[model samples]
Target: MPEPTARVEPDEIRRWLSERAAYYLERPVEELDPGAPLAELGLDSVYALTLCGDVEDRYGLVLEPSAAWDHPTLDALTAHLLAALERG
Candidate 1:
């Protein structure tokens, strides 16, 4: 794990996740719907796993591979990450 940094806000995480998901979907970050399900936004299992890795690397926190499935949407996932960071 990486060293903890300053506290992070949900919007920042949301934007980062949106940008990442958009990259995997080959879409613009503006095209992403924060309320939409990741799968519905065209993120498959491979993309999910890739995203999980990205989250770990970016946030420096260990996470279950199923974190995406558990959160399901950008909004939910952002909230989950915020909570996790708080607990961190």
Candidate 2:
């Protein structure tokens, strides 16, 4: 079996999110606008849910399935994630 990936550090979560978004959106990382809403990107509900699941597992957080919609932008999501981790 493949080794599990290491947990992401709080500070690095933003960058990781950005990269993931870029991947799902099929755009280059530099082409992404961190401030723009993720819904405006090419992401559908399915991808958003998948991303939420990944986030929960990667960060060991108990996040809602609608986390992507609730956070909206990459920056917003990053801040929310950091706060969640801090609270834990």
Candidate 3:
């Protein structure tokens, strides 16, 4: 048997976040980053819920409610999201 391949990549995760950020901020995706603070981008609880919904719908992964508070950064959230995907 062959080893399984990973479908996700760092750039893809970055792009996903970038696209979502653009949708949330009404700006270009290039302006977003893993280090960008959600508050600095004007993302509130409503936006967070929307983002979590998007992640779950798009990636087929469910994020716990606490995930928003636990993984505030894009990189951290991406890591958690990828881990959840891998688990499933």
Candidate 1 Cα outliers beyond 4 Å, as residue runs: 1-5
Tens-digit lDDT track for model 3 on 1-88? Answer: 1112456766677678668867888887777766876667676778788888888777766677667668887777888777766666
- Point out the higher-scoring one by TM-score: 1 or 3: 1
| Clash tally for model 3 | 0
lDDT score at residue 38, model 3, on the 0-100 scale: 69
Q: Rank the candidates by lDDT, best first.
A: 1, 2, 3
List of clashing residue pairs for candidate 1? none
lDDT of 1 at 62: 73
lDDT string for model 1 (1-88, tens) is 3357678878889999999999999999999999999999999999999999998889877778898999999999999988988888
lDDT of 2 by residue, 1-88 (tens): 1123444465488888888888888899888888888888777888888888788777777678788889998888999987777666
Cα-based lDDT for every prediction:
0.90, 0.80, 0.72
Q: Order of all candidates by TM-score, from best down to worst?
A: 1, 2, 3
1 against 2, candidate with superior lDDT:
1
* TM-score of model number 1: 0.93
